[model samples]
Target: MKNLIILSIAGFLLGGCTTGTSITKEGTTNDPKWHKVETILNKDQGTFPNLQSLSEVRQGMTKDQLYSLIGRPHYDDGWRPREWNYLFHFTTPGQGENDITTCQFKVIFDHNMIASSFYWNPINPKNGVCPPNIQHKQIANKRYTLSVDALFTFDKYDIENLNTKGKEDLDSLVRELGKFKELNTIQIVGYTDRLGTQDYNEKLSYNRAQTIKQYLTLKGIPSQIINTIAKGSEDAVKECQGISEKKQLIDCLAPNRRVIVDVDGYIEGTPENNPAIK
Candidate 1:
């Protein structure tokens, strides 16, 4: 049944003849001939829908499974427990004709958070399919910030000072990095809280960045593609209240002490190739 619907769509496009009638948003009558011509001339510009992926969507599929099938829903109403809406506009190719097609897919979920039913405006060719946005493949760039407290104790910049939790965090990131095809650049930037002299903080931040880079290199990340930078206390993420006591003041400025790792590379497939973060 699915194959037949796909073949029918293919044949209609190959024939260079439009078959579907276009109705207004209000479902009013329209001159089918003129509406078809207009749509053919100027189709809505949107992400291309993956018909094959959509076909996999079925009743009783869990919401997580649905998201894995379809990258992301365009619009979701928080108050609506049963409905998820996805919007798309794209140009359809048939013979040499290019027509704009716009659609809004409404997915209804049952109480168990499983997809129970769905409907699409404009009557999609593959009504039973689950469609994901067509994300073009390109170079991938990812950046993450790790708090200093998580990686090291206050004022500690040495790799030896990295705690067990910090190692675990890096291990998780390393696993994710394996998903990328070719790693281009890995930037490690360090920042510190504004508690010490400018010169001391600057040196501390630079050492911190270098320590992270060194650790990653030891873990098999190519050192040739890695770059380290020191930001010192230039950009504070949080402003601590002026406490006369120095020990308490440092704790309040903790958020500003951190390191940021930015990785740039090429992914094997589309942007959606990476699974959603758990």
Candidate 2:
């Protein structure tokens, strides 16, 4: 409402609030939120769903203990056999009517550690983000690992601050995965900062992921090695039917649009017991 914003708070934390221009003008910058997500996603890697949570999911967790810690997710949204979705709602700040904060979590399990993960907040929609310092990995079985997000920057999105650090972090992450020899198939899913139509968002997410693929290929990664897709607004971080803030329609949608990385590979023959717990 205050200004035009491109938000991606589906993360567990928030990116720093920095000034950025748009693709339109030099001064009309592109908010670095994309960069912020780039850094975070590139490092840990994977699409929205990470694991099948027990019915009672808690703040601190591990897969082995998911059954006891929490029960199972209320719903499991899986597009395919190996992939699934877990939607979670949580809060951070503010009070009274808007006091409660809500979050949606998407996790994928491969034959190894987490295949990918996406965290969202539909209430505020575009206000949560993660910090670069956080470390993530699978806990139990590699495929069905109990992954955890040591997230920071809870209330705001500081993607602009993610910077080159994000790029290098992700580059290193991919290279590390390459070391696993068993690593083979790869999928790149892209989401956008809230703006545009569902159709446009779908294409934009695809293009953005394709652009990432190009960069990865140039870095010794191969095109034949990866598969890519875009869901546009269908896979949005926040699903909104009505305007929460009419004045800031763009801002409202910022966190809803986003990009993700999904992978299908194997490790240790047994394959990670990647299952959709919810």
Best-fitting candidate, measured by lDDT? 1
| Position 120, candidate 2: lDDT | 33
Instruction: Please identify model 2 stretches exceeding 4 Å from their true place.
Output: 1-166, 240-254, 269-278
* lDDT (Cα, tens digit) per residue for candidate 2, span 1-278: 32323233322123132212122221111232122222322232322222223222332334445434433433322122122222332221242123322333433333332233323323224554321001222222122110001111111113333235445655664665565433334566655544567677667667655655666676766465566777665655555558767546655565644445555432333222332221
Q: Provide the TM-score for each candidate, comma-separated.
A: 0.47, 0.35
* Candidate 1 deviant stretches above 4 angstroms: 1-137, 270-278
Pairs in clash, predicted candidate 1: 43-100, 44-100, 46-89, 54-129, 54-130
TM-score of 2: 0.35
- Please give the distance, in angstroms, between residue 183's alpha carbon in candidate 1 and its true position after superposition: 0.9
Model 1 TM-score is: 0.47
Root-mean-square deviation of every model: 15.8, 26.2
